[model samples]
Target: MNLLIQLTDLSIKTKQLELLQPLSFKLYQDKPVTILGQTGSGKSLLAQAIVGLLPSELSQQGQVEVFGQTHDRKSLISLWGREVIMLPQEPWRALDPLMPAYQQVSEVYQCLHDLDEESAFYRALKDLERVGLKSSALKRPGQLSGGMAQRLAVTSATAGGAKLVLADEPTKGLDVSRRDDIIQVLMNSAQGGGLLTITHDIEVARQIGGDIIVMKEGVVVEQGSAQQILNHPQHAYTQLLIAADPRHWKARDYPMIEKKPVLEAKRLAIGRNGLALSNGINFTIHSGEVVGVVGDSGCGKSTLGDTLLGLLKPIEGSVKRLSEEAKPYQWLKLFQDPPAALTCSVTLGVLLEDLVKLHQIERQRVAILMSKLNLAPELLERRSTEVSGGELQRFAILRAMLLEPVFLFADEPTSRLDPIIAKEVIELLVDLAKEQGCALLFVSHDPYLIEKRCDTVLRL
Candidate 1:
């Protein structure tokens, strides 16, 4: 077996503190490796370090040998498309927003592979068709659903035929079927090479079975074959992480209570750019009710939420706000991408302060809410980009809850979080919404989560 990558006592750190502890591992040809851990556990940092893409403020130590040779950051740049490819955690952000999906992948072939335009076009189509994205080939990144964009990005990234592929949370927002499809695509793409995957999804690690490394707090607690580590995890943290999967979670109980309609949609038709994806929709969400929306990728789940929030116009019919006492500020949305919703110009603490001042919220209430959400006080001092996805997401929820929203559209709120954090976040959202009589429109790909937490399920 040939070694694809080897790290000897490699570690990552910032000016103030260390992020990933010193670690050594070997990734060989024909064997895929997965790093499993919760967000903020430095899983992403390790991948970034391997690819020499860590931020300027963060520094790395020790040796990195790739494809039988040790390389510095300068030399590593030469091997990007041909030798190493990294599929980012947020695939949408990595895509070309202005280019059609087909063109994006085709360009990679034309540039990196030195293929003619005509040849690249046909090859791109075949790749897209293989990944079930042929129909959406004409769509732009901004226009496609999260899952669709993820698939497109994968196609484009692997077009160069990079042997050693680094995929970070590649299945972040995909439905179960689509997630499986991506796993298959990645496995096929890395044939005869090495695959190093960083993911919080236990399913991803399980499906990409070979070697598994479980990390928490910048240290690896367990390492072995996927079968051994996943099934018989010896570490306490690893056991807890596995048990947090929604499939293993118990159903929650809800007591009967009086209900008041908070929002209603009648004869609704929803879509983007004058196209209707779903029509003749009618649903009423009562105050304190948790409504779950489930469907395949690109089936207009997000469009429906936008229409209800008045962010997008409905082609026909109307959405009625039955809560007469609710103010405009009381209606909010928790975005799928936390960084997209937050501003990078200011620290998270500043954003919170601004919101508190604007809404006249009490300091005590803010402190209590942070505690309930398990958000560290130190997180607020950094910008949104500085915190982990799960932490930033919790902060987003904190901001939304601070408004005491009467209606909240939480779009895949827990998708980026690990199972343990995801479970906690979902439970917190449900409990808080119910306690404050806030209606929640929760969108998720996990049916188990929907079945357990939601009072009503809306199929798109």
Candidate 2:
């Protein structure tokens, strides 16, 4: 096999700390290398280091050679799009919110491949068609679902026909069917090129079926072939990671079923921008019950939640607030992407302090909730952008739970988390909602997770 990238004792460091331990590996043509680890484990930093996109505040040690030649940060810039492409962790963030889906892909062709506008458009259209996105050619990123956005991001990133593709959590929030479709796209794109993937999803690593590197807190815990590592993992952490998959979770038994109706939707028809996606939906959510909403991407799962929360108007029917005692502040939502929900302008501590003061919430309750959410005290010192996704998500939960919400809409809250942490967060949400007699409307793409945790499943 022809070698693509060779890392010799590659490590990342901040001024005061080492983020990634000295690691060595070789990526070859046609073979994908997947790094499996939890959030804050330096998996993303490693990808950044390879692509010469590490933050200026951080420094690196050791050597990195791509395509048999060593290149520094400056030299590597010349290779971007033409020879190297890095698909970011958040597909929505990577895509231009205002640009049409086909235009985004066509732009890559026009700029990197030196094609005329007409030719680029034609090629981009064909590419989208191949990925099952031809029907969404005119739609913008905001209009598409999570899975469609992911596919578009990949198609646009690879349109330049780069030889080395580094994808960071490409399948983070997608359903099983869409996830497999993306995997197939990546595999096809890497037919003769090199693909390096960074993911927390063990199934992604297993499906890629190549070399697997497991990292924890910047340290490489284990590395081997996918079959050997996944099926016969020798490291304790690896075993723990494999065992954390929701498919292996024991079925939970929820006993307390309160009769108090918190929210009821009758003949609800939900949609966005005057477009109806689902109609005649009827359900009554009782206090302390976990109701899961499951459907394929773009089937109106999130729209349903927003309509019930009164964030969006229902096209038809009505959502009744059965609990007259509950205040507007008692209704809340936990977003799928924590960064979007939080502001980067303020430190987490400041946000928490403001919330406490505005609500006159007791200091003891804040401390207790923080402890229960497993949020570190120092995390409060940093801005939302300064923390990892998992930590930031816990902070979101801590903020919401502090309000003592009577009704909570959790929209795929743990979709980006590692299985181990995802399970913990799910349990915490379930237990806390039960304790407070709160009603939960949870949306998830993972059928296994919904099956094990939810009391009732709402198929859209």
lDDT of 2: 0.91
Evaluated at residue 416, the lDDT of candidate 1 is 74
What lDDT tens digits, residue by residue, belong to model 2 across residues 222-307? 99999999999999999899888888789977666655998999999999989898999999999998999988777899899899
- For model 1, residues 1-460, the per-residue Cα lDDT tens digits are 8999999999998888989999999999989999999877899899988888888889899999999899878888888998899999887668989999999999999999899999999999999998888988898898788889898988899898999999999998999989999899899989989999999888899999999999998999999999999889999999999999988888878776678999999999999989898999999999899999998898899999999999999999999999998899999999987888999999999999999999899999999999998998998899988887778888999999999999999999988778987888888889989888889999999988899899999998
So what's the TM-score on candidate 2? 0.93
Q: Model 1: runs farther than 4 Å from truth?
A: 14-16, 55-59, 346-364, 375-388
Q: Each model's number of backbone clashes?
A: 0, 0
* TM-score per model over all chains: 0.92, 0.93
